[model samples]
Target: MQRKFLDYFLFDKKDNGMLETLYREDETSFPPFDTQEVSFYLTPEKRLSLKYPAGEKQELSYQGFRDNITFILESPFAEYFEILGSPYLDLEVRTGAEDLDLFIYRRAIDENGKTVVLKGNHGEPMDSFTRGCFRLSHRDEVAKDFDKVRVICQPPTPKSGVVPGQIYRVIASAHTGLNMFARLGHV
Candidate 1:
């Protein structure tokens, strides 16, 4: 999604430093999961829709799911905020009545056991086609006391998509550490 690191600050996760996910100039293949499906697809509208329900009732599409993970790891905000490979990234996927299981994954590997995206310390920008405006919500899905920093997004509601309603509480953790003037400087 489009983002600007308004304020500059260094966040140390202590010994647990974050890892970044990279995007490739060349289109890469999707990852594989053991499942039977009709078709897995991701649209330019940032909507991910599949033809039919795969055998995994509790899970989302295998290949296309990876694309979303790829988008998040490569998002500009992720890079600017330096939140790539932390303990784990919680991506609140928005789907149309679909319960899918996705991961930040240590590496991007295809079904054939070949590495597609390698693990690294640098975050990459998400492809323009798949990126969009991201707004955070007030409720924290993962508790603050938890060891990992979980990034949560609203899943697409059947009626209005994934966009949040009024009273959205943006991620305040970063804002608290940033100086207002420094943030304005970036603007």
Candidate 2:
């Protein structure tokens, strides 16, 4: 019973991807569909709060981070549409640092459009904040006909450079989530 349609923001990969969306009028979101992917930093004091693992491993430098954010919904003439539970992502990941963990992927397009993509990898032990929140899924085998959720918080890119990629921050509003509990997050 969740049919209220029309929720925008089809593409946005802030700074780290260099300003990809601000809802351009009739401009069709101008040549900025996240500039071919490069993100890990969404402003408001670059958010990510849920820590307790400074076990010892330091060497940070995520040049202009810009973690992703793509929430686009436009399907409501039924025939098929189902997503129960909330879409949440106020995240936290510190899988022993050094290429931490958390990378979510999902893209759907049905109703005759045909499209699906699902990839999830959260480094085990997932992390604190009481295992913080990171539950965002529409899996009926990728929502079977259309239901896309795009929340990109890096980490898990090793093979050509053993370690360096994990900065999933998001707290600059919500009163910085009570001065940053970083919220019980997910994507």
Q: Name the top lDDT candidate.
A: 2
Residue 103 lDDT in candidate 1: 29
Q: Candidate 1: where is the Cα deviation over 4 Å?
A: 1-86, 90-92, 108-144, 147-187
Give the distance in Å from residue 97's predicted Cα in candidate 1 to where it truly belongs: 2.4
lDDT of 2 at 87: 30
Return the top candidate by TM-score. 1
Instruction: Estimate the overall C-alpha local distance difference test score of candidate 1.
Output: 0.28
Looking at model 1, the pairs that clash are: 6-183, 19-85, 60-100, 94-156
Error of 2 at 144 (Å): 37
Please estimate how well model 2 matches the true structure, expressed as its whole-model Cα lDDT.
0.29
Q: In model 2, which runs have C-alpha deviations exceeding 4 angstroms?
A: 1-89, 109-187
- Worst-scoring 10-residue span by lDDT in model 1: 178-187
RMSD of each: 18.3, 20.2
